[model samples]
Target chain A: MSPADDPCIGDVSEGHILRAILARTPAAEHALLGPGDDAAVIAAPSGSVVVTTDTLVHGPDFRLAWSSAYDLGWKAAAVNLADVAAMGARPTALLVALAVPRDLRVSFVEGMADGLRDACAALAPGCAVVGGDLTVSSVLTIAVTAMGDLEGRRPVTRAGAEVGDVVAVAGELGQAAQGLAVLFGRFRDGDDPVPVDPAQLAAGERLALNAQLRPVPPIGLGPLAAIAGATAMMDVSDGLAIDAGRLAAASAVTIALESRALGADPARALAGGEDHALLATFPSDGPLPPGFRAIGVVQPPREDAPVTCDGIAADPAGWDPYRDWDATAG
Target chain B: MSPADDPCIGDVSEGHILRAILARTPAAEHALLGPGDDAAVIAAPSGSVVVTTDTLVHGPDFRLAWSSAYDLGWKAAAVNLADVAAMGARPTALLVALAVPRDLRVSFVEGMADGLRDACAALAPGCAVVGGDLTVSSVLTIAVTAMGDLEGRRPVTRAGAEVGDVVAVAGELGQAAQGLAVLFGRFRDGDDPVPVDPAQLAAGERLALNAQLRPVPPIGLGPLAAIAGATAMMDVSDGLAIDAGRLAAASAVTIALESRALGADPARALAGGEDHALLATFPSDGPLPPGFRAIGVVQPPREDAPVTCDGIAADPAGWDPYRDWDATAG
Candidate 1:
């Protein structure tokens, strides 16, 4: 297809798709300069900033057959924004670098752009696409950088959770893991990859699939929790249990979770990751804000275990990159 | 090495590496909270910020055989920092995403950290290595995102130069290209892979090789030129002839260069890329700064060419990503 004409829905080169996506970007108010420059320029209020980056490689992290380019784009931005949000900072902008095979379709690239726009719109106010480098590679890879501003507040850190702090979470937990399970058909045994009836998958499963594909990180909640006197905060990219263990270790405290208080399927909530949910610690005496649910408490380190649930020591069972998941399942 | 020997280095496991990088990062003074929680919070100084990202792939960008891990680390930081500098902004912080084979040595990873330390020390003061994600991949790749502070200064854009402006440059030119040429052994044709004699390559050639291995960008010069009243500016990553053409087109003007003024082997100076030098434009009548040298004049569009050298039209030549150097050479 000619560049002007939309290539068949999933059939255009990445370069052509990128150009199309760039063409649709609206000029944000605080953006002095956006895409096309060597780097983007934004108005920095306090002369200080926070920056973070992440990369997603095909095969290891995702598969194109199951994921649309738009989903990949959105996920890339979401992951980086989650890091910035974990810093208790408000995201302001992003830079994206993509490597794709030359034979890839332009439509796929456009979908990726759409996904990026959707994610940025939800997470960052006045965020614009900036400079990027495009190249051909054996596998598709995406790299994203997110920038944020902390408006003169002392940054809360993982080390700040003292004994007696209440642990709370803003946003859902385990949705992404459930979603991935549905997507990969692991939730059902001997499921056909191309089923005779695709509708056999439940609607709720579809929602989970969407969650896995496009995680909506709790962006504003980070700065909000900070303002509300959260002692510490973090984005739950890994499973809640694993990430909570990290917070406890960093703060040199023991954390006890009332797993029963967590929403349905507590096991999923404990071990499922990629939720992008905000888990924060607030002082026991502090007022808890709306939407934040208390699920645990911080205490002085006890014998052996750093984290426990319902008065019993809980195994730190979650995804381990080095281990085989299938073997563990059996 | 045992994890106890380098507590600061944290666990060498991919997961542990992610935790360690995040642990030492303190929240920005303006940060409401830093990494550890669901999302980070930052106080937007003016409710805006500029962002950019780049990825360095092994083999295509650098070879482990020729460059030390530290050199690779430094170069990665320099490239991203240069992008921020090119926008006439001061870099404030960075986020790095890394992928490597699991079999890689811990010492090699330490070298990368050292390189990051050195690069940040030279370029951005107090810039934090805030957050990143790590995963296993077949090859080593680094993704870096750099954020900058505009500090209320009007950003110098490529599109702002006008006719009759004076074109000037700050920092060294062609050093990286010269270094690259020597590294590829183009200086000595048909040479064995291993040099017949270790001392055969001159010290100057070795210096050039080092330059390519670890480019030292003139980070301060960009902001300095901006403060000194530069109307337009950019970091010279591509060759001067090609990048100058980009600036001219953006400003809708023609640029003329004085070949004699370009000191020594003008062709190399004009065609070499990766200098990371800042090329800028100012009002012709304004006083130029101490380190900047006048290189050309901006003029109204002429029938001859967009960029000309010493009254003669010049071809726009430099690195083209799609074209192989070997094929072009033949």
Candidate 2:
């Protein structure tokens, strides 16, 4: 049945909805126990598990009018997997807590799961959607917690940067923020969230919109960077300036980024967020791994500031959805 | 600062609020990496991890007026921990995804964390609030995912019951549902979400309300049951009949309850939900574990139904919050 008729969550029972979604769950080779029980079991043979959670609300995280359910599923899985990668662990399984409005289409749920499975298959082959909880709510919210296998290595935390270390990144820089800006501009009146098929858009415009709707972080490089002797690492989620400031403060060092080294768009590299790229600090003498490029250097702590670009102070203005909507409509 | 006047979330920025909450996080012995990073590292010495998720919406799951931040935290932790326990695992860490209205008080978040900490401390020590995401939403929703260490034991899934197994419970039954009924009765108009100090109520009434607001499942018994050899098990979140029917159906057997054994009020014992007690099946020749009382016996599949009470058919009409709200008011 089409979601528009008798297939919307509100019209169907919870049991009916769950069974439909279960039929589409991707093969979970790493899962010891899948859904349909009190809890799911997964192997943690590494003796340690890296864990993290993120919730995307309807208004603050995404607009259904702009994002298809497939994109929502992709984005949600990508965001959480990025956290696992940031820990220098291979994401192995995810548990999702989804709350949806009754009027939500059954297709919405299936498309979301399809996105989750597709993302896992594409990004982390062994990672699976192990278990999840579904409930009714006024808004569609996805809260996902991801677990990763460290494979017996020390986690690369955000607190290990040392003075004289070289700072580097291993994924696209600032494209998400750029995409968000483009979408905002396109939906200027804020009245329209639906966009033309991205395939029909100009190349640059399409790239930006895709970045906003579907973020693909380079997941493989996190573990590689750790093995390559990276001292500290984190995903660049809330802008480089702010998150770098965090790593610097934690490591008690100052980070100095060279503008020329940050591609043609230095400001976006410094201030844009949601790239989900790995930002790391490696010993200056160590080698930068493949897909990684040096962006800055860690300096001994300066009492006045923890981050800088060249010799000037760089403002770390990250995207804050809370503040964004607090001020006005999207 | 008190949560009321100067601590509303909107008044304080997200960074400021996060730091304040971070300052109060308790020590987590099982956590290799705690909050303040991209992800937390949890000790999983066992080769396996037990995972589960539950989402509590503001209006559907709870009301802010009737429940305090502390109660919410306690209840949330208790619910998820129970799922781990049902699987015969020790809950090791929790990742909370809290979405709240901007106008909510920072104290609300702190209090919720405090409740989380206190619950972990009092109920399941070493299970820490390792990491979480805080975002803005129109409603306050808590979606928590709990990870558990199996300690190298085979999980007690719901499909292992054998014919002639004895059905037993490890904690309270029917109380939470009764408590919910009392609260709904007291708040007939539903105008007052907040209730007076429960201590002022008669013991019976107080017990009912407390069961509804804060459920303290018998956590230590799950592993003990596994050690004692429970063939099958599940937590009693849904009513006994509904959940037991699940076990019976899963195990491909009939679970017949003997009314005389389920204390007084057999209806409540059979139909009430949210008790968070461990219901399990053990070999009839084996001894029932401590804290568990026999209430039924597993029988070979019966043609009439999967579950029955006193040789008569039992209808499973457990709590369905989705349907309740679907028909009417907030």
Candidate 3:
């Protein structure tokens, strides 16, 4: 087939599409191995590799109506980057695979490219787009593989939290969750697609929407926490309460959150996820690192409750893939 | 959601599936860059990197009837590896992104992992699966990103062929086409799927099918050919005749094949692609590399022909993504 017949083709200006996409990504840094190299070369230091895979299918995870091609691209990259960061490693590079219907506009593909570039710039600077394959598909889908460098630190797995360490956060929380609520009409649906007031869009809500589309993972913070003598760490992709329970179960400990200490609305902040923030634990007396704030502490497990807030038992308040959230809501 | 409700959950056995998937993948040598490590590290020999991306959607490129989860995995890795090899580089590592329907067998996912492992075993030794994201989708799709080391060698691009160079190939051709014909019922239509008779299948045919499912690219051959003074080189994922035309057009040269010398049924070999074989050109008197066989030579461009065979103009015969092939009557 001619290039025109290749499903990913369209008439949108490639350069403009790319720029719009890149505008939202973070910057790069050293120790990034080869960010722009054919395949990035990160310093493994630990002699072992940690890997995972993720894909975003159109119509399900994202829609073309509220999100732009650039936004989609950024989100695709952000999710993968967040996964790497969650492993307590510094992300180094990425490999992207895209499938699109032949009728797609060329601008969309360029926008996707821009999103990838922007994400790499922010989270894993110098992270290069290596090699991928393209073909026509029934719908739009993106698959991304991110590479990271452990840099000689032991991987801070979910299975390592102890009975008595201070729990803390290193980035914004609940913002992306709120953003999702706004974008999907959890707040108000069937209205103007774009927000009417530019100011409302800019204040945190827009940033949250941006978070859902293009998450800026606390890339360096994971490793930095590990270096700072933090005992366990993970990126907050899932809501804090649910993910914290996971850490508790893995480490066979009880986690107690002092809800009042959490910024803003404690319940929303605790239940909301997709912040691309880092949640970590350290000795009760250890010094908290820069960009980190104390949120809670790990406690000895109770016979009936594995997670609690102060003296009260807590239940998971997060999104479930199979359950209908709107129906379950009061 | 419980793992069952998660869209990514499949019937595939987790450990065995991942192991089978890892088994097929080749290992990376400079460092451990595969699944088990916290993060993989690949050697980036070149200061500059070349990157590209592609994705495979189920039902369109492959059918569940002819392929297993393992086969899908291998095919995904093979396609990306072919691209890197085409760029005249040695593949270093890979990142895989997969999406599966929740009801899908977990074994299928594992099988896909097996296929990735298998492809790596054959073509990209020691390369690791660094990192990826997992999600649920309505359809099964695979995205692969491959990284390669250029090793200080100049990339052999499509734009480098010139007049007077002999065209040569390393690896088989047409077998994949024949296999496709057999698998898809182009050769013989029936009520039931064509049962492949093991005894009746030629070694080349078997090889071709294997190549289609898991193409073992001559990964280092591209750069090696360049080092051996070859003028241009590329992996033949498309038919030779079609790809040769591309080379000729890119370099502004004419290509002429000695049809009589090409053996019987050379058109089948020339027109069929998916071999993942390296095709290169060298000076007429230059010694052919050990694994390569001379096929044709470059010539001055004719007014009405970009390519010809036996002094007679020939029609393009490569496979097209959207067009049906009309095999010539024997």
Candidate 4:
């Protein structure tokens, strides 16, 4: 569509924009009552629902020049889904709350809805957008709340790991962080962010870029791990070293990593974040689940550090919005 | 606390801020798993859970000069709870997503948590904040998702109203809008919003200001309406004329309102919004619910407007953020 065909969202009515978005949203499998009501009713066959909320803001969370509306929507939904999955639950529905700039086009909103639908279809089937709220703001923000069902199984928490448990990970670790490196190192024009040039990216870098833009965490493996007698589980969103340290602290144990198991770039794997890989602990007596690969072992709590690499204390370096985000640098 | 004690959130770690806020948050009655986890698990005893989301942005939604941190938090939770209540369900849990500026005070966040706790305690007694996400943003925003339980009763939707139903409301009308008017008319200094002066207000204005700042919608009366055999229900976030018209269009009926039934200021009652009053339609044969009073009667679909007052067409005027919000106007 041409610019004439794309009207500014501010020029239209809220209902008009909502209708366009609602038309793109798919029917949720677990919805007893869907949109166009005061609220939507989602089925909870397991007698309880696992829910989590995550937000993507314009500046600190993402840059518009680097991330498209589709990528933003997908990342927002994927991150929240990973949280629910980390709790050993099957995602059922998503409720999106969008605060968009009025100057943006209506098409951007439509693209976001499509992205939300496609992400759910690809990452966690049977889950879809059941309800949402839209309002005007100077900053473009997407906040998503995801709900899931446990399917008669108990939720796996980070505090469940025992000393003898084997620590394992599923999905990529350093790829998303590598993508961030690519964006910062090659795709910037002075202090401002510029769009990525696909031609400049190598095959590996392209994969890394995709990992950063739209992470497909091991969603199905969460329930699998729970069923396989896994003791602890959490998604690796803020690097393996930092997240592993969190798990260790929560469980009151120390985790010692095997450097060779973390792929060729062990340092990158330990420090890279936003890949949304599943980090879980299983009993040492049983075989690890099909998709998960053992990378560490839970040990008695040590005074030095919560996590260690090759018998040495590892740096707990990861993204912390409060300490790391600098609006001027972006 | 002294000025040195109340440091900016930018100086503190995310964990420090979270711990401060969590210390003030009350334990959710329906929570199987609460905060400090990847996700929260809320009990859905009736086999299904009702969910809805609403957002409050800094500029269009509120101004820091006028509303306190506590007011913002209370309003955010109260608004979302009203939506779930309108679905004829008892609220169970709330998941908050806060995108705040780094320069704000940690004490402000703790106050917000207290507001969320107090709002839930006052409006929906059993409900409390179960989980939340906090991120940095240029524009402060609060996005809340509320979940509720039906307790075996089917939802009372706006589409279920019949021609013979009696239109009723269970809360004050025009009060919030009156409060807004007070702020705009008296508390502003040119383009910027000035702090509200309580010493300059009368008793009625104080009440109106409180209504706008922290609305106490009749949350309990929602389930009561369902048990009282109400055919249709909705919360009047927009003005009665506009929201009633929406309900009429959804139910394929016309609403004939009695102006005499409305209190003294009928025009303000018809046009003002944000009161979040529970509007319902009950069978003409049954007595009205305890908190509700008759306002109008449902009629067959007409060629004219969806809503009428004193047998004449009533104008549908309400807040539409896209068209109504002007950044320069404050």
Number of the predicted model whose TM-score against the real structure is largest: 4
Model 3: lDDT of residue B115: 77
TM-score of chain B of each: 0.86, 0.94, 0.82, 0.97
TM-score of 4: 0.98
lDDT of 3 at B304: 70
Q: Give the 10-residue window scoring lowest on summed lDDT in candidate 3 chain A.
A: A321-330
The fraction of correct interface contacts reproduced by each prediction comes to 0.54, 0.82, 0.37, 0.82
Candidate 4 chain B — worst ten consecutive residues by lDDT sum? B320-329
Of candidates 4 and 1, the better by lDDT: 4
lDDT of 4 by residue, A1-330 (tens): 987889998888889998999899888999999998899999999899999999988878788888888898889889999999999999999999999988899999998898898899999999999999998888888999999999989899999999989999999989998988888788878767898989999999999999988888888888888899889999998899999999999999999999999999999999999999999999999999899999999999997989999999999987443245464244
lDDT tens digits, residue span B252-286, model 2: 99999989987788899888898898999999997
- Provide the overall lDDT of each model, using Cα atoms, as 2-decimal numbers: 0.71, 0.85, 0.65, 0.90
lDDT of 1 by residue, A9-76 (tens): 22453346656878766565455677777787765565455666677877566666566788898999
Error of 3 at A320 (Å): 3.3
- Can you write out model 2's per-residue Cα lDDT over A123-231, one digit (the tens) per residue? 8888989989998788788998999999989999988998889999888777888888776666645554565556556887678678778888989888898888889
lDDT per residue for candidate 3 within B1-330, as digits (tens), equals 365643346444333444555565445564433454223444454543333344666655665656677788888887777766666667766766676665675556767777777777777776555544455565677777776666666666766777889888887777677677656653233433344556766777677677666666676566677678777776776787777776777678887887765556778777888777777888887798777788888888885777788877767767543232211110
- Among all windows of 10 consecutive residues in model 4 chain A, the one with the lowest summed lDDT is A320-329
Error of 1 at B79 (Å): 1.9
Provide TM-scores for the models: 0.86, 0.96, 0.75, 0.98
Taking the tens digit of each residue's C-alpha lDDT, what string does model 4 give over B1-330?
Answer: 986999888788778988898899888889999998999999998889999999999888888888999999999999999999898999999999998888888999888998999999999998999989898877889999999999999988889999999999999999998899898889978767899988999999999999999998999999999999989999999899999998999999999999999899999899888889999999999899899999999999886879999999999977443245464244
For model 2, state the Cα shift of residue B200 in Å. 7.9
Clashes of each: 37, 2, 65, 0
lDDT of 3 by residue, A64-176 (tens): 65677788778777766766666667776565566766567765676777777777777767554543345556567777766565666667766677767888888777878
